[model samples]
Target: MNLHLHGDAIPEGLSRRARSFVASHGVRADATPLEPYRERWLALGVPGEVIDRAVAYQERWGGLVLPPAPVYECGPRYLYADVPEPSHGGGWWFVGGEPRASVAFSFMIGPNGEFGLWGDTWAPLHASVEGWVESLALTHHASQWAKQVTRLHGDEVEGLSLDDFEPVEEVQGIVDTWWRGSDSLVALHNGEAECFSGRVRRVALVYSGLDKWGLHGQ
Candidate 1:
């Protein structure tokens, strides 16, 4: 399937907020500038399919200096897809990154062409770059719409009430995951917070108020 359609999968309002967030805190580049990098990857023997998805993402949603929502309370992060290089995995290629500096992980295209993060290990964050963007957008949406927003940290994240919530598969998180409920969406993150912190710093944002399009769209 074409994974690039994530931009269309999320609710329009959420996407708008995501764009606004990026505009305020990030730098977006015209995808056309990626043509040279695409040619370079091809010459480097990167698989055609891998290059396809990565190129599409860079062209569309790629950016730089993007920090996660303040609610996340994680380290500084950004989306910078400069050039492609072979990853430790045979067919994957280093494409970008989510976090920065010491705890940072490079973004890559997985064997099956999935958008992923490669740190000390590899973890697929989403099916596509736009999926990651959707997760970011939903963060703002859920936080604003929920009747009550709850922030859980460390082991407290384990006690979160996720009994009736459903996984948000489109976002396709490995360390990070999103859940939807009758009136809420829970965003659980283990990236820089839990996994890399060397401590149980897991975090979860529970957004509870989807009485309208939030529930209906999905």
Candidate 2:
């Protein structure tokens, strides 16, 4: 997927010159080193050998230059436009509007395009929301706060159906655990409609990065 960074100017405090160049060139936000190779191989149903080639290319060539600081706009739009932190391998995030429904992030593509993805959702780590939260090690007090939010939103709402609601609950459980007694923040929308902005914040909390886990082929 191609990533698109939209704003009048790239932020001033970007860390890497490379990322600045990327933004200048209009690189898609979700585009990553392995994308081209992955697309090619997936179309052909080839073996994993090509992924290795892609990784090598990234190691030798791929780098990001990021704008400094988180950029915010009116209408509840947020752009994670800081220079890609080496701590997070410079993965960028572009979250648009309230009630968010479209989002993507970078992924690791093995040689020949074997890839690992990190985003709002994933399949393999399919734990219920409660289970997921418990896994993240919340403070004892925070768990209490989280419980209130969870209880309010969990299975209580009417006509609530989400493909990842269960998993999100797991995430919420974790966030609640960590956030309790910290004056962290909580906002809930009444009625059956999910308070999607809150959900988006929950997802962003754990987004250390998309392409950091040796996707470039360690």
Top model number, lDDT: 1
Top model by TM-score, which number? 1
Give Cα distance to truth, residue 172, candidate 1, Å: 3.2
lDDT of 2 by residue, 60-141 (tens): 2233222221111111111111111111333221111121123343222212121222343311121221221122222122
lDDT by residue (43-118, candidate 1, tens digit) is 8787677767566656555544455654333423655455556656566565655554454555565665555556
lDDT of every predicted structure (CA atoms): 0.60, 0.27
| Candidate 1 Cα outliers beyond 4 Å, as residue runs | 1-27, 30-32, 37-49, 64-67, 70-80, 97-102, 193-200, 213-218
* TM-score per candidate, chains pooled: 0.67, 0.18
User: In model 1, what is the error at residue 10, expressed in angstroms?
Assistant: 12
Clash count of each predicted structure = 1, 24
Backbone clash pairs for candidate 1 read: 96-107
